[model samples]
Target: MSTTDSAPTCPVHDFNHYAELPYGEKIEFYDRLRDEAPLIRNEFANGHYIVTRYEDILSVYQNAKTFSSSAVTVFNPNPTFKWIPEMLDGDEHRQWRKQLGPLFSPKAVEGLEQKVRERAIEVIESIAVRGSCDFMADFANQYPSFIFLDLMGLPFEDLDTFLHWEDEILHVSGEPEETARRRTAATIAVTEYFRTVIDARRAEPRDDLISKAIEFEIDGEPVTQDDLESFCILMFMAGLDTVSATLGSTFYHLATHPEDRRAIVDDPELIPSAIEEILRAFAIVIPSRKAMADTEIAGCPVKAGDMISLPLNAATRDEAVFDDAKEVQLDRSPNNHIAFGAGPHRCLGSHLARRELRIALEEWHRLIPDYRLASKSAPTEAGGQLGPSGNIFLEWDV
Candidate 1:
C-alpha cells in the first residue's frame, strides 16, 4: 500500500474500525486522510481505490462517465435484495432517472412546500410547549418522515414502520445475525406495502407522488409497477433519513455555536446562506463509487471495479477549498460543497431537503427563541449516508 508523507499520517486501512469512531473523532481522521492522501488507496472489507481530494471530489462529481454511481451503496455483495435505480449505470440509469426526475424537480417539490411547511410547523409546535426535547426524535425525525409519507400518500399510521425500516437499511452493524434478519424483514415488508399502494393508486389515482409515478410514462408507455414500487422504496429511505440526519447535525452545530446561531437568528435572510454553510460543514454522508475501468485520478492508479469510498464529510472541511473551512461562517460566499454529492447521480431531493432545513431553522428559532443543550452530553456519529444520530437534548424557557 502506498502512503503519503504529510502532516496527518494515514492509519492502516481499516474502514470497519474507522466506522466505529465517535462523530467528531471520525471527522478528524478523515481530515488527516484528505491532507495526506488526497488520492490515497486503502484496504476495506471488499476493496479500495483512490479517495481523491476536495478538488478531485468536484472533478469526479462533474465527470460521472468515468466514476459511475450505479454501485453507490457498499454492501457485502451477497445481500439478497437492492434498489434498482440506485444500482444502475450509464443508459439504464438515465432511463430510470428520466422516469423519476419530474416528481422531485424544484417545481414539483414547490407544489408540496405548503404541506411540508404545515407538517414542519405541527411538529415544531408540538415540542415548543415542552421547552425540552430530543430534537432528533421529536422534531427532525418526525418532520421529514411525515413529509415523505405525505408526498408518497402513504398511510399516516405507517410512520413507525417507515422509521424502523429506514434505520435497519442504513445502519448495518452490531449483531450481524439480528441485523440481517431485521433488514430482510424490513425489505420484504416495505416492498409489499408499496406494492399495495401502487395497485391502489393505479385503480384510483390521487394527487400524490406514488399516483403520479404509477401513471407517468417515458415515451408512450406507463412506468412499470415494479419500477414505481422500487423508486417509492428508495424515496422513503433517502428522502426521510438523509434529510433527518442532515437537519439533526445542523441543529447540533447551531446549538453548540451560540454566536453562529445568533448570527442567523439576527438576520433571517441569512438562513439560506447559513443552510448552505451548514450543509457544507456537516456533509456527513460518505459517498462510495465504483471505478468503471482501470483509470488514474490525481496520480493514483484505480483498477476496474475497485470500490472507492469518498469521505465527503472530510473533503468539505478541506482548507484548500474553503478559507477557514472548519469555522461555521453563514456569510461565506460562493460555497460549493458536494453535500448532496456530485455527478449525474446527485441527490434528486436536494431542493426539498434544503427547503426543509430552512424551515427548521427559521421556525424552530422563532418558536423557541431561547434554547440550549440539556446538559454537556456529547453527540453520537455514524458512517455511510447517515451522519450523526441519537438525541440532541435541548432545554428552553416555555
Candidate 2:
C-alpha cells in the first residue's frame, strides 16, 4: 500500500498515511488497516496511534478520561487561545456543552430549517441556469458559510472573507512555513474580529450565539473573555467547515451514482437515510486526542501523553457493524454511523448539519437529477475532517 509518505520509519497509520491519496485509495488503505491492524501506532510527528475497528474506536472515544483532548492546542489548553468544550474534559467539557448545546439542540435547529432551505435554494438557483459549475465552490462551500454567519450574527456580506480565512486554517496552501504563516495570520485576524464582537455583545446583547456565549457561565461566574473567544473560534471553524466538505462528498456520490440519486429523488422521504449512508460511506472527521493517562485500547498498552487518533472515518465502514460496509446504500437502515462522532463530544452542529444536508440533496437532485464527473478522473478526496481538497466539478444539461 502506498503510504502518505515514504519516510523510512513512518508507520502506515500516520496521518500522512492517507495523505496525497485519492478517495478510493484512502478507503482501501483504511480497510486494509481495519482488517489487518485495527490498533496501529505510528511514530510520526510527536507519535500517535490509530484505533480503526468500530468497537475499538468506540472504546477509545468512550474512555475520554484515558484519552484527553486538551493536548489539542487548537483552542483550549493553548497559551493564548481557549478552545472551549472540545478541549475540556470530564465536568469541564460537560459544563461547556451544557451552556453551548441549546443553540444546536434539535428544537432550535428545527426553527431554523426555513432559513436553511431558503439558503439552499438561493445557492442552487445561482448555479441551476449555468448547467455546469464547480459545485463545491458555487454551492457547498458558500452554503454553510451563510448558516454559520447567521448563527454567529456575523455579516452575511463577509462570507467570502470568512471562507478565505477558513480555507487557510483548515487546509495547506504551500510549504510548511507558508502554511504555518497563513494559518497564524488567519487565526489572529479571526480572533481579533471575535474579540470585537464579544465586547459588543457584552454591552448590547443580541439573539446570536455570540450573545448567548457572552452570557454563559461556569461555576456561577461568566466565562472568561479568553474562554468565550476560544469557544467561539472553535465553533466558528467547526461551523464553517464540516458541512461544506460533507456536501461536497455527498454531491459527488449522488452525481455519479444514478441509482442512489434516483432512490433519493424518487422517495424524497429517504433523503435523511441517504444522508446517513453518504455520511457513513464518505465520513470525513479524523480527530486525534492525547492519552491523558496510561490506558489499554483493546489491550494495546498506551502511555500518558501519547496521541491517540479516533478516526471515525475508518470505524463507520467497519465490516463488523454494517453489511456491504463500503457500498453507499441510500436505504441503509439502523445505520448507526458515527460520522458526527460519538460520546460527549459528538458534533454539536449535528442537528443543523443533518437538516442542511437533507435539504441540499432533496433540493439539488430535484433540479439536476442527472449529472456525472465532467472528466474521466474521479474528483479528489482527502481523508481528513475538513473534506476534499479541490473542486468537484459537474456538468449537465442547462
Candidate 3:
C-alpha cells in the first residue's frame, strides 16, 4: 500500500553522523532513531533512507519491484563492483540462482560440515597455547579464510594478500574520494588476481569448484571469462568479510558478557541457539537498495535514485518485534530476524556462516572458554558488509 498525504512525517535528522562514534554507541544511536521514526532521511553519503524498524525493513525487502538492489552500498555513490545475485534483480537474479545456487546451497554447505568443524578446531588449537592473541587475526579471520579456501580451492599461501585487500576495501577512513580510490584499487588488484586463477583453471582443470565453474556454460553457450570473474569477485566480497565480522562481534559479546558466555559454556547444546541470537544482535552487514520507482516507505515519500539503507543490523533490536530487544537471550524462541536479509538476495552463505559460528564458539569454549577484551584498542565499525572491528584483541588464561 503506497502511503499518500496524511502519512507519518519523518522526525530523524543528522543521525548518520553516528558513523563517527564507537560501534556500540553507534548501535545505540540507531535504536534511538528507531524510537523516533521507522523511516528517517539521511542527507549524507549521497543522501539515503535510514530504516530501523523491523517490519518496515521487511516491507521494503519483500517488495523488490518497488526497491532495487542496484544501489547496494550507501557509502560508495559510484560502486566499484556489480556483485552478483545481490545486485541482479527480477528474472536476471533468478536465472543466476539456478546455476550458482548449488555452490552455496544447504546440501553443499552440509557436506562441508566436517571441514568447517575441523578448521574451527584447528584455529582454536593454534591460539589456545598463546595465552593471548588478537582473536580476529589469529583465529576468527583464518577460520573463514580456510573454509573459503576449501570452497574455491584457492592456495593457502595467497591468504595474506587476499586478507590485505579485504581490509583495505572495507576499513575505509579519511575523505570519501580517497577511500573510494583505495577501495577501487584493491578491487582492481583482486580482480586481476582472479583472472589469473581463471586462466590457470581453464588450462589445467582440477577437482575444485572453481575448475568446474571455469568449464561451465549458461544456457547453450559457454559462459564468458568476464562472467566467471564477476562471480569469483562477488564470492570473495560476500564470503570473506561477513563471517569474519559476525564472528568478531559474537566473540566481543561473549567476552564482555560473562553470563551470556556462561549460558553456552554450561550447556553445550545451547551453542546453536546462542549463535543465532548473536547473529541477530550483532548483524555485521548493512546492504542498501535504490528506489526502483518513486515509493513510500513507512508512509514517507522516497524519491527514485534515493538510496534506502537497509540496516539489517538494527532489525532484531526493534522493541515491538523482539522482547528485550537489546539484551542477549540465547534461548529466545521464534527468533526470526533478517540478519541474513530477505527475499531473493538473502545471504547465500547463511548456512555456512551459521555452521562456522556455532562450531567456532563451541570448540573455542571447549578449549579456552574464559577470556576478555584485550588491547586498549576497541573494534571500530567499517564497510557495508562487515562493520564490527576488523582487529579485535583478546587475552585469556592458558
Candidate 4:
C-alpha cells in the first residue's frame, strides 16, 4: 500500500518496445510498474524516467515550471519533429496556449457541433447497414478526420492524405531510417497543406477556425503563417487521433463487456457517465514533461533536462484514488480523472471530445445495440496515437 517505492532494480531495456506489446499485456506491465517501480529509470533505447504512480504523474503535470514540455519528444528525448506549441513550456507555452485557447472553447465547439454530429452520422451511417465493418477505418478514423477538416475548412478530398500522414507520423514499425523518412515526408506534406489553406483563408475569408486565425491578432500583430500552420497541424493531429482512439477503445470495451453495454443501453441517460468512465479506464496518451530545473517529485530526485513520461492511463486507474480501481463502474461519482490531462497543458479540445463521444455513443447504440466483436479477425495491434489500430470488426443482426 506504499506509494513511495524506489526505482526498480531490474533494468528495463527497450522501453520503447513496450509500445508494440499487445494491449492486455501492456496494461498488465503498466500495473506492475505502478505498483513496484513508481520511478523506474527506463534505460531502454532511450534513457528516461518512466513515472507510473498517479501522485507522481499528477505532481509532474501540475508543476509546469519545474517539469517543462518544450523538449523534442514529450515521452522520450529522441523526437522526429521539431518543437511546436505543445512542446513549449513556461511563458512561451502560456502565450501559445492563449492564441489557441478560444479556438476550442465550449462556445466555439458548440458552434461546430452541428457539423461534427453531421459528419459523425455520415460516417456511422455509411457502415451501419453492412452490420460488419472495420470500425477503425470507417468510423473511428473517419469521424475525427472529417471534423478536423471542417474545423480548419480544408478540402474534404484531402482526408485520405491526412490519414496517411497521421499514420506515418504516429506509426513507427519499420526500419529507423525509413520511419524517419516517412515522418519527414508527413511533416512537410502537413505543413505545406496547411500553409496553402491559410493562404486561401487569407485571400477569401470564411466562417471557420482558420479564417478566424487569419483575422486574430496577438498584441496588434497578425498571427504568423508558421504559427498558424503549426497550430492547424497540431489541431488536426491532436483532435483526430485522441478522439478516434477513445471512441475505438470505448467500443472495444463495451463490445467485450456485455454487462457494461447492457447497463448503458438500459438507462441511456447514463451515456455521459459511461463516456467518462470509459475514458478514465482506457486513459490513453502517455504524455511526457521535462524537468526545467532540479526538483523532487514524490520524494524522487529529478534533474533539469531529464525526460519524464507520465503514464496518464496508470494514474487514472491508480488504486489509491479510486475504489475498486480496476472495475469500470458507469455510475462512478465525482470522477476527476485527468484523461485529457491537467494544469495549463490540459487538452483544449475536451469539450469537443466529450461532444463527439456522447454523440457517438448515442448514435452507435441506436444503430447497433446488439453488436459483438467478430471471432475471426484479430484485434488491431497498431500502437502510436490510435493504439490498437486493427479493425474492430463487430457482427450484428440486421
The TM-score leader among the candidates is 3
Clashing pairs in 1: 61-343
Q: What lDDT tens digits, residue by residue, belong to model 1 across residues 290-366?
A: 66776766755666666667767666888988899988788899898888887777777888888888888888888
User: lDDT tens string, model 4, 1-398?
Assistant: 01122343423534563255444566666778888766777654346677787877887788887877766353335454444467766666677668768877888878876777787777778777888887787788778777777777777787777777877766555544566677778889988988887888789999888787777565567777777887777777785688888887888888899998888778889999999998888787777776767666655666777777787778998999888777899989988899988888888789989988898888788767888888864554434234426557777887
lDDT of each: 0.72, 0.75, 0.77, 0.73
What candidate 4 gets wrong by more than 4 Å, as runs, is 1-13, 72-84, 174-178, 381-388
Cα error, candidate 4, residue 103 (Å): 2.8
Residue 141 lDDT in candidate 3: 74
Off by over 4 Å in 1: 1-12, 17-20, 50-52, 76-84, 175-182, 218-220, 384-389
Per-residue accuracy of model 3 over 68-103 as CA lDDT, tens digit each: 877677765445457665787887678777877787
Could you give me the TM-score of model 4 versus the true structure?
0.91
Clashes in each model (backbone N, CA, C under 3 Å)?
Answer: 1, 4, 0, 2
Q: What shift in Å separates residue 188 of candidate 3 from its native position after superposition? A: 0.8
Best by lDDT: 3
Pick the winner on lDDT between candidates 1 and 2. 2
Worst 10 residues of 3 by lDDT: 1-10
TM, every model: 0.89, 0.91, 0.92, 0.91
